[model samples]
Target chain A: MDRRSFLRTSAVVAAGIAAIAAGLAPLRDLKNFESVEEFLQKHYKELTPEEMKQALERISREVERQYGLRPHVRDLKPMDGVEFAYALNLTRCIGCRKCVHACVAENNQSRNPEIQYIRVLKMPNGTLDMEKGDHNYATESVPEKGFFYMPVQCHQCHNPPCVKVCPVEATWQESDGITVIDYDWCIGCRYCEAACPYWARRFNFTEPSIPRDQVNPNMAYLGNRPRHQGVMEKCHFCIQRTREGKYPACLEVCPTGARKFGNVLDPNSEISQILKNKRVFVLKEEVGTLPRFFYYFDV
Target chain B: MIKNYFRFLLRCARIALVGDWRYHLWLGWLAVICLLGLNAWCKQLVHGLIITGMSDQVSWGVYIANFTFLVGVAAAAVMLVIPVYVYKNKELHDLVIFGELLAVSAIIMCLLFVTVDLGRPDRFWHMIPVIGKFNFPGSMLSWDVIVLNGYLILNLHICGYLLYTQYQGRAPSKWFYIPFVFVGIVWAVSIHTVTAFLYVGLGGRPFWNSAIVGPRFLASAFTAGPALIILALQIIRRTTDYHVTDRALLTLRSIVQVSMLVNVFLLLNEVFKEFYTGDLHASSARYLFLGLHGHHALVPWIWTAIAFNLISMTLLLLPLSRSLRWLDLACVLAIVGIWIEKGMGLVVPGFVPTPLGELVEYTPTLNETLICLGIWAFGLMCYTIFLRMSVPILQGKLSKANETPGEINRVCPAIQSRTATST
Candidate 1:
């Protein structure tokens, strides 16, 4: 090659390499690289029982390693002939936010930048309009006169728009009438977040941080396990607890006994009774999500 | 024949590598910006999407907005292709390549914008067609994934075939590319329409739940895309010896003019539907066009875009725009104007009074903005390299007959002289 042309080519090459090197310098910030086992993990449904056991062991180890908490993690299966449903009595709810905090604690949600599954909407007595509902009402009070508390969470809809919009089938409706997300499979496109009318889903924008003592010992594959950054999460109806025949943390914490949960398929279940006899309604029925959650009033 | 094709690719690569100081400087600037963007992206990877202004409420921000606009730009290639290929407009006969090249670059940018927007970009393989789960026929996003990749491949094949044939000094087989061109025209529409469907299919976002979104997307895309081409063609004419006829620019101008009007008309229809009817769902539109409950972050931006569109549309309609200066101004106006209208004006409002009626305004963070700017720079660099390689081949300066690779520097006197003088 000629001297001048050679110089030009070398100069360009040098500049290019230098630029790329400088650009990649920030990669040093990637402290927690994924293990080969984690990276090559199969989709949730595709995993065999042995693989799932290994996965659960890995999660327990990860939780221990990260937070010094050795928790019991399991892949809880839904019971056959059971379609779980929730019923909330509006007249009994006192606008207290214990359910929200209990959920955060039980779900192993991030504490500093708190991730709460339940949002209690303080609504006026006159209208069903959610526009008038105040999510951020700060007062030292319980059921401030003339206002009703309406808690919103994942409806686990029968006709889930969120599931339909998911390009990767990351989030899907489970057999027991609960919507679930496979964090490992989710690409985090946030399309499901946009499709949900209830604003039920939440994305983990950063690495979830929880105090060591605050980490819930009990975990589920699709529920209360500590989530990685950049995945979607929501109320999976306390899957770890519920799949084991225990009530959801939110219902257990409701001081007024307003929250009710049971298998809708069972004729004598509280939820089935609420639906059959009580004056029950679902929020945003016009959107046609056909929610599993029912609201009722006994005033 | 295969050996000759390999030789053609090598020669093209060589041509791209050796350019004047101006080219080097331009490329250097782009590379630096791309690196800076890469740096920012790395930070985002480490920190996660918390670095961006997006939250659970406003899940999509600048990235999705840019992706939407660039899809329109990419689809605008069909605007030029239809006239030259189908209608046989001689003025744009040679110029159609430029539009296709732009489409190629714009689509790459579109894909990049989507990539950077992803929270778990590491799991991108999950969306792949066969190997991955591939939720086809159910998700609009999967459809988008199909149409966009299809359009990109279609454009690349057309451009590659035409250019390779030119380098060999042979007539291109009409059958190989002609059918694809027709398919491309329809494919182009599907790309933008599918992107529109991505927004419109979301019944949760009332601001985007309108029949007019698809037509509006096409209209705005045609306007901004052609407006950008007219400006690009003018720059190419000034810098290079390649002839870009005034008629070509004028034809594109006319397209921009009509589409701009249609774009405005469609926008007006949306406004009337939102404001005149004054439904409860119109809160987002009310927040956008006029401040709602004193939270008016986007009101100024929407107004500026509207003003730019109106002024540019008027100028494009006038005889004064027959002059290049007025035409240039109008094109610039239309490009920037439609960018805002189609981008932030459209995407942001859909999330403004979010599905829950909570007013959470979005403002893109520095890291997000850097990544966006970086993608744009990379796209521009790609277009520049594509032009650098293709122009010599189109002019017959880098044909197979040259045989000896060393003959390139001797034959291309314009480049050598330009480099010599610049140095």
Candidate 2:
């Protein structure tokens, strides 16, 4: 070959090598072959029953390794004839933020960055204007004078904009009314966070910092199961506890019995009774998210 | 024929690789900045987006802002393509390729910005079709992903085929390229429209929900894109032997003047709607313009953008200031003004009052700023390399078959001799 052709061939070969090297550079951070498995894992819905079992077992093992707790991670499918719903009595709620803490403890939320699903807004009496509400109020007492408390969490909407805007369908409303996220499947574009009117979704900006002692051993594949950094997460109505005929931790921890939780499908359920008797309203009804969560006044 | 094509590419690569001291200096500076950015990105990957100035309150920041602005820049290429091909404007026909090149680079930057802004860029394959379920038709973001990628591919094809044919000293087939060029014009509008929809479709963010957002994006894009081209042409004329005619620059100026005027009018219309309506939804606008409840972090920045835009528009409106020096200054102003108008001024305020009505301020961290600068440098490098390669073919220096290897050295002696001296 002439000098020119040789040089041309070498240049082409060099560029090809560089391109391949650049492409494979990101794979170095994948750690080992196990991460390759994690990367190539199918979407939660697309997984076979065998794959699902393996995934749950893998996640359980991962949680045990990371958080020093043998988490009972299971893929909790929706129960037959049970559609979960939540209601909060504004009169009883005193802006104590007890439910927020309870949620963190139950759901294994990151403590350092402080990822709390619930946001308790303190607004003045006779104002439905959410803009007038203060989320960062630091008062010493419970429910300062004329102010009322509204603790906001994922409504698990029937027609969730969050689910609709998820570019990967990583998040979706379950058959049982609880909107769920396949944490492993999310690309973390934060479109769902933007779409949610209530700002109920939280993004894992960093690795979650659950204290070893505080790590909740009970976990759900669709709920809190030791989330990795760079994924979208939010309230899943404590799916780990809820599917097995128990109230969400937030409901259990309420001091004044302000929070009520049950199946809206059953007429005998507490949420149903509240919907029938109380003048209950979902926040941002105009947005038409059709939240399963409702708020009411005892009067 | 294939050997000839390979030879043509090698010649172009040689031209791209070799440059004078000034070019080396500029490239070295860009390389340093890129290295720094890569370092910062590594730290971000390790620590997560927590290193960013963005918070739960402000989920997006400078990276997304830059992405939004660059999408407008990329979309601006159609302005040249439409006038030249449809209206038979010969003055702009020579320069249309430059605009296309700009689109390619801008779209690349847009894609890069989006990639860096992602929380899990490693999981990007999750958005792919079939292998990963893309929520197409349903998600505006999915639509954006499709259009942006499609536009990039379309431009690459058009530019590649045209430039390749030029290098081969043959006429590009109209059947192959013309239909695609028309498709590109429509596709350009779709990219910016879809990007705007990414914001406007969010019913929660009232600031971006305005009907005027899509139009505003188009107006500002048309203004910024051509304004950038005018500046690029001036630099090319000064530094290289490329013959960018004054008439071409003047034509671009006219496009800029009209678009800037429309952009300003749209801004006024948006301002009137927000301030006059006096609703709770206007809270974000109030915070942007007049500041809300004493939190006025973005107030100065928005007003500065408005002032720069108006000043540039006023300059362009006058016939006397249409001289090269004044026109160049106006173009620079228009480019910066639209960048601020669209970038931080537009993206940040949508999340300022946030959906929950909190007033947490967000300023990009040093790491974010460096990364942004690095991306800009990388884009410039790409543009420079593309121009270096194409300009020779356009000049008919490298396309002649009889030209020997020794003749290639004589044709562009500065690069060829520099290579010899360095080695």
Per-prediction TM-score, chain B alone: 0.95, 0.94
DockQ of each: 0.83, 0.46
Per-residue lDDT of A119-150 in model 2, one digit per residue for the tens? 99999999988888998999878879999999
Identify the leading candidate in terms of lDDT.
1
Please report how far candidate 2 places residue B31 from its true position, in Å.
1.4
lDDT tens digits, residue span B1-423, model 1: 554576678789879977888888998889889989999999999999999999988999999999999999999999999999889999999989999999999999999999998888988988886667988899999999999999999999999999999988899999999999999999999999999999899877888888899999999999999999999899888877888989999999899999999999999899999999878989988988998888999999999999999999999999999999999999999988889988889998898786666778999999999999999999999999998888888888878878673554565656445545866
Please give the lDDT score at residue A43 for candidate 1: 83
Top-scoring candidate (DockQ): 1
Model 1's alpha-carbon lDDT is 0.90
Clashing pairs in 1: none
Docking class of 2: acceptable
The C-alpha stretches of model 1 lying farther than 4 A from their native spots are: A2-8, B405-423
CAPRI band of model 1?
A: high
True contacts kept of each: 0.84, 0.61
Model 1 backbone overlap count: 0
